[model samples]
Target: MRYLKVIAQDRSGKGVADTLHVEFYEGDQLQRKATEADRQRLKSFSKTYLKCAWFNSGEGEDRHVRIFSHNPSADGTPETVRLHFHEGPVIAYKAAAHDLDNDGVFELILSSDVDNDGRADRTDRNRVRSLVREFLRVGW
Candidate 1:
């Protein structure tokens, strides 16, 4: 059996949670020893993160997890190790456009109730909308 200690940190490189220790002996064996730097790179390599469950701090800080362990695959079948770091809920947003004046130009309508609160508020939508709009306008 092999054991590993995975420590998660925030975008600022601050520890977010205690080290998550896990043990596994089944399935294919681990391929390599993931280091702190490797973990950081992995985290940062992710272009985007999952959205929050509901209205939150809107601080999508980059998170990194460092796995401290030793490879135990000796004379065993070569296998690959893949890791995915998800911080929030699995969600998607919807938007539409309406021509109020019927003149052809349509005003954008965005949904803010991603959490299904039954009410549309700016809490959950502003951050994402603003960021996207800014990126489109300023070419970020």
Candidate 2:
């Protein structure tokens, strides 16, 4: 029997980080589905707040959620969403592990603007380069 599940999708790629649809599932059935109808319950809901996204396994946890902004020019602008299946607060970070890079331990990937464009793309090489530079500045 399946014990845990997650569902997320990006909504847009224009300005800031927008809305995402998420849900939980068990077995082969969907337990919850975040949809437009449910979003109406919120104060401000716009199509700009929703878009398409992709998901990949992050290091150091069973799962992680990375929300990318709507900037075609910038990649690596993911708003890391921490998920804790238990009861209290659990923090999740962008990390790398042995299975991730053929290494044994885990490496943590911190948050950095990397790009000066004020937005992040999902797989931009330049943005990732900038992020690495900023992240490794050291003692500054």
Model 1, residue 113: distance off in Å is 4.1
Number of the predicted model whose lDDT against the real structure is largest: 1
Report residue 5 deviation for candidate 2 (angstroms).
Answer: 6.8
lDDT (C-alpha, whole model) for all candidates = 0.31, 0.29
lDDT of 1 by residue, 109-138 (tens): 345553344666775454334323322222
Q: Pick by TM-score: which candidate is best?
A: 1
Write candidate 2's Cα lDDT for 90-132 as tens digits. Answer: 4332321111232321133333222224444433333333323
Off by over 4 Å in 2: 1-15, 27-29, 40-140
> What TM-score, computed on C-alpha atoms, does each candidate reach?
0.24, 0.23
Measured with C-alpha atoms, the lDDT of residue 67 in candidate 2 is 27
